[model samples]
Each structure stands twice: as structure tokens, then as C-alpha cells.
Target chain A: MTDYTPYVAAVYGLALLVYGGYTLRWHASYKKLERQLASQSQESP
Target chain B: MNILKKIQPLVGLASLIVLAVGLWYVYQAPADFQQGGAVRILYIHVPSAKMALASYIFLTVASVLYLWKRHEGADILAEAAASVGAAFTVVTLASGSIWGKPMWGTWWAWDARLTSMLVLLILYKGLMVLRHSLDDPVKGARATAILAIVGAVDLPIIHYSVVWWRTLHQPPSLAAGANADIHISGPLLPPLLILSAAFILMGLYMVTVKARQIEASRHLDALEAARLHHDD
Candidate 1:
């Protein structure tokens, strides 16, 4: 009977924040690792 | 190109597109007669809850593969799944609590379903901690895998808790049995189903990205150790 637009929006907003934050963090970590591995390979020989 | 390079981009793009479409469906669906706009929360909450359990099952299976075949890749996958699973569980609990506040009139209750789901979140966190606690990588993987296998008992318990005990939580929504109560249909069901698929694809993409990160980390560790040995 009550409008719960705010509650529904909060859940979707939270989902976006959590998933987006995680994706960006992991993508950045992977890129850093890739760069490190590339540098190491170059230094090896 | 390697298999991962070929598949990861497509999977990532597909997840995003499907998730957008699923959101569109949710937006277009009419409000529930009883719960009004609040029912929209079910679109995210149900899929997240399902994915949380699904991810643990994936981790358990990967753990079995790692233990049976001595596959390092499997261990990496299990690790990736655990992290992703933990994220989904957090979403599930937080979203469920939001929904509960309006419907159940409380933030949380010590019910079987809710408590078991909480236990599942704990198990996932425990597995991650156990994996990193040991100095020896092999020993850490072994202990984590064993714990994963044993912790899988909670999966069945989580699934059946509502049916087995009297609880404030509602019975199964998608699952069918004597205890099944919710029969969502017409405009309401499509968004839920589509979002579930979208969540699975998104979960898979996250797992793959994490697996690559873990693989790279292990390689770096090995290289560092080898250099140390050579210098010594």
C-alpha cells in the first residue's frame, strides 16, 4: 500500500555500487600485475 | 589468441547488455498488488541469493577437482569463486534485509533460512582466510579445499531450512516441492528469470577476471622465489 520507490532504488543502487566497485578494483589489480610481469620478463634476458 | 582472451571480452559484454535489458524489464513490469513498488527489490534480491549459493557449489566442485587431480587451475578457480560468492552473499543479505524491513517489520530475525544464509557467508569468508593463513601455498590450498568440501553440507541445509522448520521467512520461490509457496507468473516472472541469467553471466565474468589475477599473482610469486634462490 505504501510507495517503496526509495527502498527499491536503494537495493539497485547498492548492487551497482558493490559490483562496479569490485570490477574496477580487480581490473586495476590485474593491469598492475600484467605490467609487473611484463617488466620482469624484459629484465630477465 | 588464448581461450581466456577470446572468451572474456564476449562474456563481459554480454553480461552488461543482458543486465541492462533485465533492468528494462524490471522497470516495465507493473507493481505488485500487495507490495507496491517494493516488490521490485525481488529482482535483485532473488537472483543474488541464488547466485550466492550457486557460487559456493562451483567452489566446492572446483575444490573436488583440485584435490582429485592436483590441478592448480582448479584451486585458482575455487579461490575466485569464493570471493565472488562472498560478494553475492553480501548483496543477498543486505538486499533481503531491506526487503524484510518493509514486509517483516524488522531488520532481521534469527530464522533458519536467514541464519543458514549467514552461515554460508561465514563459510566463504573462512575459506578465503584459511587459504592465505599458511606460508606454504600447497598446504594452504589443501586445507582450503578440504574446508570447502566439508562446508558444502550447509548448502543443503540452507536450501531446506524453510521447509524443515517453522520460520518467518517465506518458502521457496523458484524451487518446486510440497513446501513451495510462491507462484510468480505473467509480468512478474520474466524480469526475475532474465535477471537471474544476467547475474550468472556477470558472476562468471568476475570469476574469470579474478582467476587471471590469481594466476598472475602465483606466477609472480614463483618468479620472485626463483630469483631469490639464484641470488643465494
Candidate 2:
């Protein structure tokens, strides 16, 4: 029987890492765009 | 009333919850099964493969919409789905290989299922390349739409490859008969379902966000063009 614990941990850890990295990147990009829009709106006024 | 705006945050929260539950299940998995703890890799690998298949389906539908309706949103959705689908395909292959190393005593196989998945990955990459090669947005959309539709022909073959060929990979038990090969107990089933749901939701959220970014970039370009025209 294969000892599955370490492999399982690695798989789940990788998934979490990918998803977390994506979330952080998405949040940062959205925030940067929001800031740009805000500044644009202020300039227009 | 604004459904699209509400989807992202909701999906993000749901994905996090599902991830948590999936981790909990992994922690609880038995240590002495025939496959050992490596069986836990199934949670991520299987779900990602499913997502990859579903993503192609999404691309096909969106491609049809773009061709028939000439809708920019549909075209953008197809493009976004291609990117996510490609990423999921990579994840599926990576997790599968990792699991295979210990179980099958090999890291790679040229079986039909694996080969078809590799083809899908290549097709998706081609679509992305086509999307970037054209300068005109409309032309790029049309070209990629055609590619997406053509690529979807591989999905069914990929799904049935194990059944049709002599292969190292096992046929999908989930589709053959719910309880045929491996029984998913009460504890594991809920989290598996939740994680699958979460991944789909998150995928949709990412696509929408990407589409919005594309739209914003287009708007900025248009504004720049208008300013130059006015100055002229």
C-alpha cells in the first residue's frame, strides 16, 4: 500500500498555493484599477 | 439586481470555504489504505480535470454565441475561459503525475487519455496565440472562436479514452457507476462536491474579472484616440 499522507498534503498544498496566489494577484490588480479610476474621476471634476 | 457585479466576491468566499473543508478532509484521510496517503491527490487532480473538461464546454458555447450573435462579451468570455482551462489542464497533469510517481511507479504515460489531454493543452495554447496575433479585436475574436469550437471535438474522446483503449489509467468510476470502483464515504463526498462547486465558481469569477479588465483597457485606448483626434 502506498503511504498517501505526504502526497495528499502536497497536492492540497499546491492547490491552495495556486488559488491563494491568484486571489492576491486579482485583488491587487482590481485595487490598482480602482485607484486609477478614482484619480481619473477627480481629474474630470 | 446587478448579478454580474455580485458574482465575484460571493464566489471568492465560497472557494475559500470549500478549500478549507477540502483540507480538513485531507487531514482526516486514513493513513493505511492500499494506495496510502497518495490517494488524497485525487481530490485536487480529479476536480481539476473535471474543471478542464467543463471549461472547454464553456468555450464551445461561448464561441457559438460569438459567431451567431457577434457579441463582444461572449468573445471575451471565450478568451477568459481558454486561459483558465489551460491552467486547470496544467494542474490536472501536474497533480496526476505527482500521484502517479508513487502509485504507478512512473511519472508519465502516452495512454489515450493522457495524450488527448496533452492535445487539449496544445489547442488552448494555439487559441491564445491566435488571440494575440491579430491586431483587430473583432478579427482576433473570430479566429479564436473558430479554434475553440474545433478544439471541443477532443473532449468526448478524452473522457472515453480509458474505456476504448488498453491503458494504465483507470476509467472514471464517477461516471461509469457512482459506486462501481471506489466508494466515496459520507465524510469525503460533501467536501469533494463543495470543492468542485467552489472551483467552478472561482473560475467564473476570474473570467468575469478578466473580461472587465479587457473592457477597461479598451475604454482607455478609445479615450486616448479621441484626445489625439481632437488635438489634430
* Candidate that scores best on lDDT: 1
Poorest stretch of ten by lDDT in candidate 1 chain B: B172-181
Expressed as tens digits, the lDDT of each residue in B14-113 for candidate 2 is 7677767766766675643344555567777778888988888999999999999998778867877887788788888778777766765567755455
**Model 2, residue pairs in steric clash:** A2-B36, A3-B37, A4-B36, A4-B37, A4-B38, A5-B37
Model 2: docking quality category: medium
Residue B216 shift from truth in candidate 1, angstroms: 1.0
* Candidate 1 lDDT over residue span B1-232, tens digit each: 1466579889999999999999999999998776678778889988998899899989999999999999888999999999999999999889888877777667785545566778889989999999899999999999999999988975686657654664434454312221211545677999999999999999999998888888888989999999999999
Lowest-sum lDDT 10-residue window in model 2 chain B: B173-182
Clashes of each: 0, 6
Per-model fnat list? 0.71, 0.38
List candidate 1 stretches off by more than 4 Å. B158-181
